[model samples]
Target chain A: MSQIDLQKILNQIEEIQALFVFVQRVIPYLEEIIRFVQETTPLMEEVSQSILESSKKMPTAVAELDKVSSTTESAASDMLDGIERMLDTINNSISLIDQINEFEKERLMKEKALVLKLAETLDGIEETQAANVKQALDDFYEEYLAKNCLQKLRQNIFCLQNDAYEIMNSLQIQDITTQQIMAANDLIESVQSKLVALTNRLSFLFSASFNVDSSQVKIPASMSFNTMHSIQDINNDAPGKTVETHDSEVSTNEHPNVDKIIKPAENSTCPVIVTKEKQRTNDVNIEQDHFLQE
Target chain B: MQKTILIVDDSATIRKLVRLVIESMGHHTIEASDGLEALSILTHTRLDMLITNLNMPNLDGFQLIQQVRKKYHKQNLPILILSSEEEPEIVERGFNAGANVYLYKPLIPWQLRQEMNKIFTQAKLGRD
Candidate 1:
């Protein structure tokens, strides 16, 4: 062996020592992580089981809340509907009162016109004839005209007063509707706010209880002999053959093709490795046995 | 057919280690004490791979790789850089210089073998 080979052997031995130390350090850490997982799994499972039960409770609570919200919504909607109907009724009554007031004003105008015509008739008579005419007119008023005129005008005033009362009542209805609408708005807002709060609480609870299993922390081994052994197997079957075959025949090219297959042969201690005779005899034995069997 | 590999480093120990690894693999290794010596050998002889150390007295591994990459543009030579330095910047520099594998020492034989095997296989596939 060359001095270089001796030096490499020394280096390999050092590397192996370092690798052993590294592995020694790492194995405990891995065991600790594994042990921790093993110890913590039951605790985690218990926590998860409790969370699952709590999650079950959440759905029932959510369902109750949903029912309450739906009922409240329906009740509020019905109240609004009733209020809307009341408003429509008030609006219709107000319109009717306005029509009655318009009819009363027309009646009043007609009565005033009749009163003016009577005054004009009285002006057409002379003053000297007034004593005789006044007596006759007084008799006519007492007997026929006075009763009719006073009764008709009183009836018109009564109708007008009744229309004004109706208008006042309609105004009161409108005020009550406005108040009811305001109250309904407040109720709806409060209910919606409560529902939103419940939803937010549910979201928080859901997130908190969602169990996350800490997966096994995998750390690479310091030096895996198994991995090395597999690599050696591959090298033995393919690359090793290439190296042995190529190295036997030297190339004349500026860049020899053999450079690609070169590696430090690790199995040098096996004295039987380089010999062709041992392999040939083994092959011959197999062949001779096969022939004998045939 | 002895696969010829060039080892470039100022450290006698590292060169010796690499030479041993190469020989143990039943391949031939040529030594260069520095980047300049590596460059001279590279010019005269064809190599399968170059295993080098980054820090050297004259013409460090980086300069050597640069020179080789420029000269052997057609050779498709695989280079392995062995160094004790663990700085990210230094590793990037080695990669930038066209090193196929960067090994931090103390070198593991198995790891070294694996890397060498990969380079050889890849180089062979490229030829095929």
Candidate 2:
């Protein structure tokens, strides 16, 4: 009985000694793992803090994205409206060209009639001049006997020549005015061509700007603080402020929701500012009362 | 002693009108279509006065006046500007270009005579 127990006790002791050796072998690996965990804890905490900060900013980012989307939609809508207006203006210009053509035709007709009338008047003057020459020749024989009559005839001839000269001088207005009108027409045509080129370029730029798909537009998650502030500044700026016009109806129609979007924030801020001003006044009054009491 | 005047203008009608008015005063007039043509005529002929209209092709009245001034003094050969343009700046430019007088067009014959008489009186005084 004693030998059996001793043998069993010795085997258990050997097993215990093997277990201690195994534990000793694993201790450095355990220490390395613990050190690794300790080193990674700060990184995990930083990750958790970063995730918490992102979560805190998510609403603001989403709101900013919504605002950007709205702004883009509004800008695209305005651009499309501008394009429509431009097309209408082009149509009006086309109609104006027809009007100009009609006006030119009428001007030409009037000018032609005036020319015909002028030619008739000139022919009549010529006939009258020829008759006067014939009369003068016939009267010369009768009048040449008298020196006084000859003098009167010479004076009459001079008067007739002066009248003809004056008539010739009065006709220069047409040519000068015609040249001025032609120059003005050339200037208008040049301006029109330049305007058309400008309109085409504007149309191209607007089309490119508006063609960006809103659904595909993505705001970067890791946007810098300065960039975020710039985005906020852009959001705070008055929408449709770039458009200026004499027509109030057009402006109002262009940005129907602008007042709706801005009025609530304005109203809320106005009350807050007024309340703060009142509180400041109350604080000043309280300080004055305390000083008077002292 | 009839004075010979050189008339430069783009318009034939205006030239004729000016010629008639000037010739009525016993002055002989030689016509040219533009400043360049007037320069050609002036190189060959001795002229008492030069009457030019502004805004002509090839050479303008200012260039003509400057060129004429280079050859003749204002007292020797008086340059008169006859133009339809009534702008003050244009009148000032004409005077600056060495014109003795700037007269707006649709000119009265008496006014032309008066101005010419004044220029002639001045020229005569200068000669004396």
Candidate 3:
């Protein structure tokens, strides 16, 4: 409107030139950011997928092992019952055989007198059949069928009772195995809870930093995974209850109770995320390199 | 005299097996699955001895022994540790907790019988 403002017009042109140069400088950073996201997305997803799969599979594994322990325990109990019955039956049989042997001994005394007199008369016979009959009679009389045969039967029955007891003793292995299974189940359960916690933390951090769809990696509410669960909870308490783990008693007492381990006030940017920018850090420590802050 | 002994172990099979051996010795036995249950039994039952395992949930053998020794004399309610635990430090801890004797698993029946007899005999002799 007034005289031509040549200096102002020239300044405006210079500003436009500077804006173009700044945009040109920013293009490489933008491309790098795109490339970084393109490369890192799959790796982060893979890690998340691994944690998710492990958390899901851990409980099933623990359940199968628990079934094995309980089934074997029941089987062992049944075996012990069978052995006890065998011992009791064999012991009764031994007592009965002892009584029969005593009765045979008395009868054998009378048969011996007759056998000796019969042998004296049998000595006069020369026929082969008669000699065979005489030989059988001597064997029967001398062998004392009631005492020798019946007493031998009793001894064998007693041996069987001892064998039954031996089997009963060997079944103690089940107890050792049960303890071992419980320890293993506890360790697995512990790892599962820790995995779930870690997965949740990582999913939150990744979604906040890189806009990753956390829902894919984060376990749903249905999983309801809790820490410190154990398979030894015959007490029928809650899954995360203190009554489950054997060593939990000591550990729970040692740790102070907390309402929540860590919770954010709201969804916010993680300070340590660098967003694919070049930077240098003097702090070698990972946490304080408070390193990703660029 | 017939002494009443409390058998404390998490394993039901072990409890039953130990019960049989104790009963065969002509003494009575009471059973509990853990130290907490054993402590409850000790509150109301008059027991002459306690036979416990080292490893268990809720409360372990050493803790139970310490609690028992606090309430009863070391010799009054004689504590015996029967366990598969082979660690010398754990065994020593059991003895330090007021255990009167310790026995290992897979011990022959006659050996257990003899040990039980020795416990009773020693108790009798101590009382006399």
Candidate of highest TM-score: 3
Q: What is each predicted model's overall lDDT from 0 to 1?
A: 0.56, 0.58, 0.67
Model 3 stretches astray by more than 4 angstroms: A1-37, A105-147, A212-294, B1-3
For candidate 2, the per-residue lDDT at B84 reads 82
Worst 10 residues of 1 chain A by lDDT: A282-291
Task: Score chain B of each candidate by TM-score.
Answer: 0.94, 0.94, 0.93
Q: lDDT tens string, model 1, A1-294?
A: 999998997787557545544554555466466557657766765665555555445545555555554455444444444544554455456566667656755775566556555655776575444355455555654565344444454465556545533332233333233334445555655655555566556556545633332332222121122223222222233221311113233222221111122122364211011212333321111112211122
lDDT of 2 by residue, A1-294 (tens): 699998997687557545534543444455455445446645754554555555455455545555554454444444434543554454455566566656755665565555555555666657565455445544653453354343454455456545554555455554455446546555655655555556555556545643543222211111111212112212343542212123221122233112111111211111000111223321111112211122
Judging by TM-score, tell me the better candidate of 1 and 2. Answer: 2
- Indicate which candidate wins on lDDT: 3
Candidate 1 has which clashing residue pairs, if any? A246-B1, A247-B1, A248-B1, A263-B25, A264-B24, A264-B25, A265-B24, A265-B25
Q: Provide C-alpha RMSD values for all models, in order.
A: 42.9, 31.3, 20.7
User: Candidates sorted by lDDT, descending order?
Assistant: 3, 2, 1
Q: iRMS of each prediction in angstroms?
A: 47.8, 22.5, 1.6
Poorly placed runs, candidate 2 (over 4 Å) = A1-159, A206-294, B71-75
Docking class of 2: incorrect
